[model samples]
Target: MVRNYKRKTDWTEKSKKAVKNGQTIRQAAHNYGINESSLWRAVRNVSAGKSLVSLSEASQSRIIFFLEEEAVLVEYLLKASRIGFPLDTSTLKSLAYDLAIRNSKRSWRTQKSAGKDWLKGFKSRHSQLSIRTPEPTSIARATAFNKTNVGPFFDKLKQLYEELSLTPERIYNVDETGGS
Candidate 1:
């Protein structure tokens, strides 16, 4: 297969190293096999205290959310997952649109929802996260009460109850099929 993707951080460190060693941008570019224009831009950005890794070149001009905005979205998704209300891609896209609107972003105001390309980039950027389909359970496995897992679970629950002195009114259960 022909390799079409540009390596995002390919010359980030090497370019920085060469510049720090007092080499010119052209010299760094030649030594590191990076485009001279790219090296020049990186050097300017580095001098201005910007990140050495070029987000624009890394994303190949497809990025919408800035690094900070993306970080906020990531934190929101993670928090939702921890609380057991994971958002699917469609909902996430809608939420992104909403967030952009609420933040008064003029550029994103034209978009109804985040596009598939944006979603693809988002997933690629967060490749460490695993998105998987839940396995279908057998009726026997579902019905069979597994004492090993359940016993400790309830024990922890009881422990929490005692520690917190929780009332019955404070406890509420949520299931997957329940309506919002």
Candidate 2:
């Protein structure tokens, strides 16, 4: 659920300044069209030595990783997907659990893995990541077809053909697929 507050950051700052400049909290809040309670809290925070510029909106307390950490995680997921090794939901959850453990975050209810709610929240935060059923592929087929292996195989085949002085007419092509 998103909160559509009527007051912007400048408005809150103006209200706080007005209260500081002898205007009553009610008058400042009414003039700026901000909630009185919120304005009061802002004023209180200012009085308590918190800088006015530092009084920005707070993030959710339940977030396990910092913004930068989450960004790194998102990048890792993207790289993994680009490499034809996209992680499933369970694997993602397990990874999240491992991350939390490594970071010493023990606030989660489930010790084994991240909960479904966390995954849902993670997906919502990172719109680029979507859950999809990946097509089943054989391990050999997936691993053997990459450029690092194919390039060398072709180079070796060329060297072999050159060493044998093979001619195009004497060469035979084999079709493993049994197609005409």
Candidate 3:
């Protein structure tokens, strides 16, 4: 379920400023109607030299990849998809795992691959990509309409028409060849 939590950046900044200017955490949180711990964290972040906007925009959970790294990954995924070799979720996870391993990510030590939660988050972050089951195609059907078969069939059709001296009006397509 999605939370309807709206961040009051203006009020948060005001609360943080109040805390910085000698107001207690409880008083600031109560005055701003924000969580006391959250206000404390915000004040701490401000003291640590992070801007209020960055504090407000920061995600609660740590992202596995940086923005530029994710951008490169997104580009590769799109290019592969356009070239008719789209990656499935499992393959994507494996690739992510390999990337993490290459980058020496400590958290990925115990896991074989990136988790489903990571895939969910990745999909949410990148709106352009969507998961879908591709329509199945039989090998015979796919290979049946090639130039080798189509050229001869059309040639035979032209020959039959010429031999029979058939006019355009004489041609008719019938669905049923059976009659009662």
What is the Cα-based lDDT of residue 151 in candidate 3? Answer: 99
Off by over 4 Å in 1: 1-62, 106-111, 132-180
Residues 1-180 of candidate 2: C-alpha lDDT, one tens digit per residue: 433245445877778878878999999999988899989988898789886443233435567889887888889898887665888888888888888888888855456888877888788889878655676879989998999979998899899999999877776555752222
TM-score of each: 0.44, 0.50, 0.51
- On residues 1-180, what C-alpha lDDT tens digit does candidate 3 reach at each position? 223367456777788788878999999999988899988878888789885654335654556788887887788888887676778888888888888777777556677888877888788889888655455789999989799979998899899999999888877555442211
| Residue 114 alpha-carbon offset, candidate 1, angstroms | 0.8
Models ranked on TM-score:
3, 2, 1
RMSD of each: 10.0, 10.0, 10.4
Residue-pair clashes per candidate? 0, 0, 0
Q: Model 1: clashing residue pairs?
A: none
Error of 3 at 19 (Å): 8.1
CA lDDT, every model vs. true structure: 0.74, 0.78, 0.77
Which window of 10 residues has the lowest lDDT sum in candidate 2? 52-61
